[model samples]
Target chain A: MKKLFKFEFRKLLHSKSFYIIFGLGLLSIILFMILGRVMSDFVGDSSEMYNATATMLVVLPNSGIASLLGTYLVLFACSDFSQHTIKNIYARGYSRTSVYFIKYLLSLAATLTVAIFYVLFGFVFTLVLGGHVASIASYMWANLALQFLVLVGMHGMFFGVAMICNKTGVGIIVNVVGIELIFTLLNFLMQIAKIEFNILDYYLEMILANLMNSQQLTTAALVRAIVMPIVYAVGFVTAGWFVNRRREV
Target chain B: MKVMIENFQTNNVVETENLTKVYGQKTVLDHVNMHVAKGDIYGFIGKNGAGKTTLMKLLLGMAQPTEGQMKLFSNGNLNAERHRVGALIEAPAFYGNCSAVENMKRFAILAGADDNEINDILQFVGLGDVGKKHVSKFSLGMKQRLGIALAMLGKPELLILDEPINGLDPEGIKEIRDLLLRLNREQGVTVLVSSHLLDELAKITTRYGIINQGRLVEEVSATELMQRCQQKLHVITDQPAVAAKVIKKLSPKAVITANENSIDVVGITVDSAKVTKELVKNEVAVQDITFAADNMEDYFIQRMGGKA
Candidate 1:
């Protein structure tokens, strides 16, 4: 299993798509930082604007990290199918379950790596631009932890879609349209119906928003934030594994 | 029944009994019973969509058989013994953007082969100088060679190659043929290669399994096939039954088919003079005699019920 993991991770790490996505992510962050600086200047009162900019950095994980990592995982997971390289693994006696699990673990690691790079660079850029770092230190660590879970949960869903679909175009559509548009539409309908609890909040994006925007994390909210994403991660990954095991490829 | 049976030893590298594969309403492979002996270059002959690839897939555990059993290396547990076998079911599958060595290294790792052996495998497949050239940039022949290199990674005991020499030049074909021969002769590796190039397959194969419409029509050895297809004397005689009896006495193993006006004597190593003498001794009169032989293509055509 360790050998399989190392081989799979190396394949992911050396892929041209990995470098392309990583570079584009860095460039986008740089552009956002520059835009933040310009907005602060135009709004006047540098210290107040700097605090706002730092708050924006904290909130960046909510949307930016999940979508970027989700897109990458969707593409990465479907590539083996498109290229037919998965045959090599199975033909060499690796179990389909092991292959699916390793790919999931690698996707998680890739998401973490990209997220860490984004945060480190965002922090350094904020300091260089003289933005005052916000002091929500008490809950900041917990927020970051919750954000990590959200990333995992989102990637798990995308990975499952990629494996089940086994086609690049279908995977991308499921990740972008199926998850984003349909789920958001469902959430909006629930709100219009005046439902007290939005069931979609148990999913990745809603849980991420709740974690990032809530001023004081309640015990129930905290439990949901931690437990829901883990559930999503495990449930989707297990589903992907099951499908992979039965799949002919 | 003319199928080849060279080595009479009890060891069989691959054996399948009534193995079937069904896709939706279509049965792609139906009750295929195939046998491949150890150290034999078993040629799997079939036309397109004749279930050749499907059988290889079942043997490799890439797809499960709908019914029946397949034993590899004397074990029916394919998941456990599949590591001892290496296969290329169709066109070589790899990360086209990665170099040949890189692709091999990845498979080698999965195959539990030492990383250091990648270079040797690449060299063996005649892709030694393909350094750093990504597989996407490779020619069809190069891609095929790299696929072979990938299969040879762990020094597997059994090799299942599907249309391996399809896109090769004559020289490339010869090279691969020699390579397969070397592997079989020197390393004792059993090969099950499927190809439409019957002539090329005839050159190196020790045994053959002919499949048609998802059914195994025949399995033959090189020597037995040669004997079955060898030139024979066709004698037109006034008394074919009497002539046949006379010839059978001289060449007991001769395959003789007696018609009203003729007796076709096949697989017999006797001269026409001896046959005539024996017939005269039996008081059977022969009017005419002719010689004929069938090449592998003709034999295959005849076996498949086509006009040969």
Candidate 2:
């Protein structure tokens, strides 16, 4: 199993698309910084620019990390099927369960790596733009934990979808259009409806928002943010493993 | 139970008992009972979509049998013994973006092979100089050789290759054939290769299992196939009965078939001088004489009901 994990990680690191998507995530931060400078100059309000920069860093969990990781996992996971290399793995006596689990862990690790890079870039941009970093630092640890869980949940969902579809184009559509776009839209509707209870708290973006705002870090919120993503991660991976075992490849 | 023990004691590398695979309403492999012996170059012959790949997939445990059992290395535990088998089913599958050596290194790690063995196997398959060229840039024949190289890793006891020469030129086909033959001869590796090119397969295989429409029509040794496809002396005469009687008198055990206008002497080395002299002496005039030798293609066509 260690051998399989190492081999899969090597393949992921060697993939051109993985680096391309990761570069895109970093590029988005630089682009956001540039856009803030131009907007501040035009509006003659430096405070607006600082607020936008802080918002970008705050929402990096959902917009930058989750979306980019979702796209990357879709492309990376489906390559095994599209390229037919899954046969080589199975032919070597590795079970489908081990393959799926290793892939899941790899996706999580890759997402965490990219997310860290995004945070580093965000910090540098804040310093370069002359904005105080103290506001972002207070919630940084909490938000980082929340982002990690969100990524775990997101990776699990995308991994399951890609494994089930086993086609690159279909995987991309389901992850980007089906899961991300549709779930975000549903969460927006819940906000508009002004529901008393936060039923959509389990949704990835909602979890990110609540974790970013909660100052006390209560037990119930911790369960919702931490334990729920773990449940999503475990549930989706188990289902994907089951489906993958029976697939003909 | 007795039959199981008997098969286990023998040198069979692969044995399937009434194995069947069904996809939806169609049956891909129907009750396929096949045996590949140790150190035998077993050629699995079939046409396209004839369940050749399906059987290989089943033996590799890539797919489960719908109705029966498969034993590899005489063991019923497929998972434990599968590491001793290496297979390339349908096409050569590899990480296209990775270099040939990189792809091989990954497989070596999975197969528990030492990293040093990678270069040796690559050179063995004629891909030594591929260097850092990714597999996506490789030609079809080059990719096929890499696939063979991957399968040859870990020095597996059995190698199952399906249509390894599908898109290769004549030279490429000959190279693969020679490699397989050398592996079987020098390393004593049991090989089960499937191909539609009967003539190419005939040159290297020691035993053959001919499949038609998901059924194993026949399984015979190369020597037996040669005997079955032996040349016959066809004598065309106006009076075949007289020709048969005259030829029968000389060689009493000769297999003479008297047709409408010709007599076929099966499995007999007819000395033209002696047979002609005997026919002239018997007042029989031979209008035409020809040797009809059946090649592998002709035999395959005949076995498959002329479908080939």
Candidate 3:
């Protein structure tokens, strides 16, 4: 099992797409850091007033981090077919169960790493920019964790669809069209119906919105946000395993 | 007890009874039956789209047979026995980001290999030096080598390889052929190989089952088929017509077909001295007498009726 994990890690690290996504995220962090420093130099510190203005600037763009995590998920799940490497993995002694879980674990690990860095960098930048850190850390962590779980779970759905289709293109299309566009639209309908369906909302986005503004949100909304994504992640991964095992190679 | 005893007697390494597969209206495999013995290098020979790949896929548990029953190693337990077998269904593809060792390790886990055996298996396939360097950087031949290495992992007793030597240069072909022979002869691994290269397969196979139109036409040991597919000996002599006349009386079953100055005697056991004596007795000045037998290519072409 350790050997299998090691192999999966090595493959993920060595992938050009992995490096590409990481590089893009790293570049964005650097750009934000430079921008924050320049803004602080221009508008002298008003720390005596203890304003939340700088915190807003730093954390608002963390949503871009979510999009970055999303893109990474897309590429990582699709790379098996894009590179035509699934057969190699299948022929090896690892069960399909292990393969499915390993992919999920790697994607989750990646999302967590990026999410943590995004929050940490945003907080440190805001402090240097002469603004109070606020109670954003706890909320940011909560929001990022929810998004990571959801993204990882969504990636599981992508992985499952890819296994069933045995082609990367179909997986990409399903995620882009079905999950991003179609499901998002369905989520809109649920919201408009006023049927008391808060779970279908963009939980990460809502939490990020509350975090940036330092607003006190309802526990019911927060609980729905956290629990729904975990369900998606677990449900998608289980379905993927079942489909992969039963489907002919 | 009678039923249990009957089951024990049918212990073939691979058996398919009336296995059929159809893609829409076209039938790729039509009720094909195959039986391969344990520890046999069963060479599967056929033309393109002859269902060799389909048969291999069925045995490897990659694709379901549309009709009929498929069994492996005396039981219908393909998935349970899959760990004991390794297969390469088509052109071996590997993850570009992984090194040869890393790729092997991933498959080793999937195939259920112990931790200590990964390095040994990599070395067996000549990828021992593949450290840190990703498979993307390896040559095509190297990838194919890694594929075989992965297949040999877990010390799998049964190996199913599809076109194992395809895209390989002459040296590459020889290397793989030697490796396979070693695996079979030294380790007692049973191999089922499918190839369009009949001559190459003829060199190392223990037994061959020729498939045409998705059906097996014949199954015989290589040694048994060698007499019928041996190398042809062409005899060129002065007074070819007179030499042929005398040689005909000696080897009655010999084929007396002529080229320019040579008479071709196919499928016959001929002694050079005996042919010389007979030609001289007929007053035919003997210069040189050559004898030739049918090679594997000739036999394949003749057997396949010159079909592509």
**Residue by residue across B18-79, what tens digits does model 1's lDDT show?**
99999999998989989898988999887788899999988876787899898887678777
Error of 3 at A247 (Å): 5.1
Off by over 4 Å in 2: A30-59, A120-143, A184-200, A216-223, B1-10, B232-267, B271-293
Best DockQ among the predictions, by candidate number: 1
Candidate 2 global lDDT? 0.81
Error of 3 at A91 (Å): 2.7
Give the alpha carbon lDDT tens digit for every residue of B8-55 in model 3: 446468888899987778887888878777788999987788888988
Q: Report how far off residue B53 is in candidate 2 (Å).
A: 0.7
Candidate 1 structure lDDT = 0.81
The docking quality of candidate 1, as DockQ, is 0.65
* Model 2 deviation from native, Cα RMSD in Å: 5.3
Native-referenced DockQ of model 3 = 0.25
Stretches of candidate 1 above 4 Å error?
A: A37-63, A131-136, A188-203, A216-223, B1-10, B234-245, B248-264, B269-281, B285-292
Better of 2 and 3 by TM-score: 2
Candidate 3: global Cα-lDDT? Answer: 0.69
Q: Give the CAPRI rating of model 3.
A: acceptable
- Please list the residue runs of candidate 3 whose C-alpha ends up more than 4 Å from where it truly belongs after superposition: A1-6, A26-63, A93-98, A120-249, B1-11, B97-102, B105-134, B137-139, B227-308
Q: Model 2 over residues B1-308: C-alpha lDDT tens digits?
A: 99977865478899998999999998989999999999999999877778999999888767878999988888898877878988898889998888998899888888888877898898888999988997999998999999999898889999999999988999999998999988899999999998888889889999999888888899999998887678778898999999999878787877888999999887675576788899998989899887778777878876765653
- Candidate 2 clashing pairs? none
Cα displacement (Å) at residue B40, model 1 = 0.6
* Model 1 chain A worst lDDT window (10 residues): A54-63
